[model samples]
Target: MTTITRRTVEYPADGLTMVGHLALPSGHDRRPAVLLGPEGTGISDLQRRRADALAELGYVAFAFDIHGGRWFSDPEEMLARCLPLLADPDRLREIGTAARDVVLAEDRTDPERIAAIGYGTGGAVALELGRAGVPLQAIGTINGLITGRPGEAAHIRCPVWAGVGSEDPIQPAAQRDAFAAEMQGAGVDWRLTIYGGAGHAFHHPLDELPDQVLLPGVGYHEKHAARAWRDVLGLLGECLPSSN
Candidate 1:
């Protein structure tokens, strides 16, 4: 069984104590570390579960909180807290760096074998970390928007894999195509996987409520989620290894 521990780390930004769940591999030392960025709603049970799953795969995973203790009952409230952070690109980069610091400080964590994975708004934060030249082994995003703007794809020193829904209204085919072009132009090892028939937030199984921003009729696709999970693990395995 994977061993998991919940802890709190203070971010210099706003001096806020963000609660995090750390998962460690059983009977392992100096394992790779992963900084997991939660969805816009903050760190939930699902995110914790993902961290545990990562630990089971032999990595020390830390899931950081963006909203502290605040969780929104409505989508608007979530957006209210997440949108401003997204709009200010600098803050987004700070959040990712703060989370990375927390994970790297652990004695058992391998600093050179670190990665960042995010969902939705958190995904954008991960992308910003890559854009800011954070020395991460890999970066992954789930159903996140990657605005194809100049200087966005450049400076990514690591491989990036973005999982998006082909039917996601927020991120259409054109946007994904543009992002791919930018990554290729930047000479970054990047890949985008489009899941057909899935809508936005395809990895969020609990997003069944009636939210205008996210379709209430749309729900998580289990098959696609499983596939994405495997793909993420493969990416991490390639980017973060004990030997490397």
Candidate 2:
């Protein structure tokens, strides 16, 4: 197994202390980097693990944080905090940019070979960064909010890959159609995948949250999760190749 290093990184954004998990592969050579965003509940161990996995795959991954250092198990609590942030695109840009600065400042990161990937609300931030004209090689989102403002997608400078559950109420057909239409209108290279037999947050493992509420249409599907991960890695390989 390839050795990797992990560290907690603290940053600032929107008057909150954002704490992210940064993972680096064991090498001196600069490596391609990814900025990872978490679900609306905030940065959890799940996203941290994804950072480690990306590091093992030879990329520097920083699991960017939102909600300061807190995570919500209650949907109401999460929505209360996330809804307002989601509504303001400039605020979202601040959050994504703050976390992104941390990753880019890393000595081991290849500044030109960077990407963004996010899940749920985090995914929305990734899109925000892209639409804000961030120079990323690719953007990969799963179960993310794909809604965009008018003419904003024209700034996207790289490919985008989005994966969502077929029955995801949070990202129903209307949202998907709107996302696609925007991408097409902007002449952006994008693809969307609808995993069959899956619902919202289907990639999430069983809830380990202490006060977890079992929400409808938000269950795990192991097979689809794996498939989506593979698709994400594929996007990275195709965009920011290892040999870069």
Query: Candidate 2 on 125-210: residue-level lDDT in tens?
Result: 99999999999999998998567789999999999999999888888899889888889999999999999989988877885565
Top-scoring candidate (TM-score): 2
All predictions: root-mean-square deviation over Cα?
A: 2.8, 1.2
Off by over 4 Å in 2: none
How well is each residue in 1-244 modelled by candidate 1, as lDDT tens digits?
6455545555554246667777777664788888888777778778888888887777888887777656566777877887788778888888788788888888878788889998887788898888888888899998766663487678889999999887887778887887788888999998888888888777777554333355453468888888888888888878786343
Best candidate according to lDDT: 2
- Relative to the unseen true structure, what is the C-alpha lDDT of residue 99 in candidate 1, on a scale of 0 to 100? 81
Clash pairs (backbone) in predicted model 2:
none
